[model samples]
Target: MHKRSFILTCLSVVVIAAMLSGCAGTMVTPTQQNFKAPVVTLDSMEVAHAFGYWYFSKKVKPTKGKPDNVGAPLDLAFIFNIENPNEYAVKMENLKFTVAFEEFDLNTVASTDTMWIPAGKTNQVRVHAHFDVRQSLLSLLVTGGFQLKAKGTNAWAQLEKWWTGIPEYAVPVHVKAGAAVFKADGLTQVTTFKATFP
Candidate 1:
């Protein structure tokens, strides 16, 4: 009787252990789907000359004790003509902008921003950037490229849940230019542009 009771207890333990293992193996977890951004090619670039201007306000100062005089503000603009050059339309969830002194990369740069783009379109992007006389005054400046990325979604969310599960895209900027100057601070930049289908 003792032997039979011991065997029964051992079998029960084995059964319970197997059941627990099975349940653990069947547990599910959420995961992000793999996504790829469309390939973009640069067709051409256009940049205007930077004009020098100054402004003084109640909060700021001017040169030679000038009484709070205001002058035209320094403005810089660039237009990029990009080509999709792809057969299929690419969905850009987020865009990344970066400024480089000589070479274009995430590191060894100044600032970065994110935006979005549509598919099969040649967009004309405008970047309003300001530069100041800091660091080395004689640093040679070149063009930079924006990095682009694509988001993945298995299903579309409804109006209330639309904000959920929407992935962002990243893109690179490639411009053809060299050597420029900007202000040290108080600079406002703008990039309002689009790409059209080629």
Candidate 2:
């Protein structure tokens, strides 16, 4: 009888330990996931002339002065209008992107958002980009289209973790656009515009 009771108690303890381990495996934490911006339309405005002849005379035949190297850095801005078109609010983070110019890899850019838009709501986001004109003009003159690529964090996984009560890092963004040459001379040039997110 004593031997039998001892064996029964050991078995019970083993069963209880197994059950606790199973419960711990099921435990999860809740944390919000990253938001990904949909591929929206990218529209470009008219390409305005960056330089114009200022002073010149037809008097005694005079040789043209040095090329108007005023604007050396070109500024290009593109606006994207995004529509929420979804049911859930997207948390913006963990996004990565790259830009290609004239078939050459240039650089990667980062993005920032000032506000968040609720579901079925429309908002505006802005992206500002600048590049060296001397390096870009050759490409622009050859190819009219500038390549752009972007990527964002996975929202669903983040949502699942959040719902499960797990802590997660904030999402990040990646942006990139082809560069263009400037007509004038300048060290730094900037392009600023706004994108409407619906």
Candidate 3:
């Protein structure tokens, strides 16, 4: 009887070890080929703060040998939602997009802020864009001049309309040529997007 009991104990140990080995095999790590690109959407856009919306300074006094400058500042904040559909978490490495007022591309905004989105979950990111009247005027003249002329309007008039209309949601704002980089399990993906804001 003692010999029989010894044999049963050995068999039980072997069975337990086999079960553990099988469980370990089931716990496989996700590989690069298993990665999927995260979905990105424009959650909202806000005129966070705007001062001197209609105010323009010209021929300002020089300070510390700096040349005279003109400035009227506007700040906008864009919020986005990143959704990870994979079974593993994803890290957003960077995001960038062009800001367009109506049909004119005014500036390119970017964020290097990194965040990890959990598996089958979502995360939010906010990026800010700043615009100056003087720089915007130059951009319009150099890049969008022909587009403006075709529309039968001048640069200053268009700038004024944007400055006054954006805060009131009367003019449409666009996010164009957007690219966001995400990484997970040694895999990298670039996602592109375009959105319009009211």
Candidate 4:
């Protein structure tokens, strides 16, 4: 009986340890992650609005420094759609993202926020990426493609990935983004395309 109890106790300990590690982000970044696992994928991202004398209807020039107000500086708010295809609820906290304009070497960090992605549904996260507006029409002439990179982690998100049998983690997923197509007057050229998901 003592031997049987000892065996049972050892098994219990091992099972508990396994459960704890599974709930924790041991293999999830701060370690390793499966990027291509597709726990969550970027469904779509759009430049919903253009603020400043450029994209706005008003001809008033945006201010330079206190640019949150239109005519102060040129700013753009992008709408992002993130989808959780898994049945497990995955959450991301204090996620960081960057929209990089490699052609112009301009890059901006997105706003800080937490994203709670529900299972099998799409979550919308809006990021306002800002750039200092020059007095010239330079930004209006920006053309070509850019890259959007985002990284976020929650133990739940990681657990969900592993639950789906993905052993690796994919941090900072990269998506091919077209640059803000614009005309000479700062008017954004309206074009529709799709954002690819991994």
Q: Largest TM-score belongs to which candidate?
A: 3
lDDT of 3 by residue, 1-198 (tens): 999999999999999999999987865456767777888899999998876554334455555565544656889999999998887778899999999998899999999988899989999999999998889988999989889999999998998899888889889999999999998766798889889997
Flag regions of model 1 displaced more than 4 Å: 1-36, 43-45, 52-76, 81-91, 103-119, 135-198
Which residue segments of model 2 deviate by more than 4 Å? Answer: 1-39, 45-71, 94-96, 134-198
Worst 10 residues of 3 by lDDT: 52-61
> Positional deviation of 80 in candidate 1, in angstroms?
3.5
Can you write out model 4's per-residue Cα lDDT over 1-198, one digit (the tens) per residue? 999999999999999999998877443331112221213334534333433232222445455433232222434355555555444445544333444332223444434465555556777766654553342123323421221112234322332332222112122223343322212112222222223322
Q: What's the C-alpha lDDT at position 69 in model 4?
A: 23
Report the candidate with higher TM-score, 1 versus 4: 4
**Best candidate, lDDT-wise?**
3
| Superior by lDDT: candidate 2 or candidate 4 | 4
The per-residue C-alpha lDDT of model 2 at residue 37 equals 36
Please give the distance, in angstroms, between residue 111's alpha carbon in candidate 1 and its true position after superposition: 10
lDDT of 2 by residue, 51-141 (tens): 2112222343446555442323423344544444334443333122344432343335556543344555654444544544434434443
Q: Rate the local accuracy (lDDT) of all candidates.
A: 0.33, 0.37, 0.87, 0.39
Summarize candidate 1's per-residue lDDT along 1-198 as a digit string, tens digits.
Answer: 999999999999999999999987864321122122233333432323333323345456545665543433222343444334333333232233443322322122222332333334565545553433221111212211121112221111111121111111112223332221111112212222323211
Total clashes for model 2: 29
Error of 3 at 46 (Å): 0.5
* After superposition, candidate 4 runs with Cα above 4 Å error: 1-72, 134-198
TM-score comparison, 1 vs 3, better candidate? 3
The full ranking of all candidates by TM-score, starting with the best, is 3, 4, 2, 1
Best first by lDDT, ranked? 3, 4, 2, 1
Summed over model 1, clashes come to 32
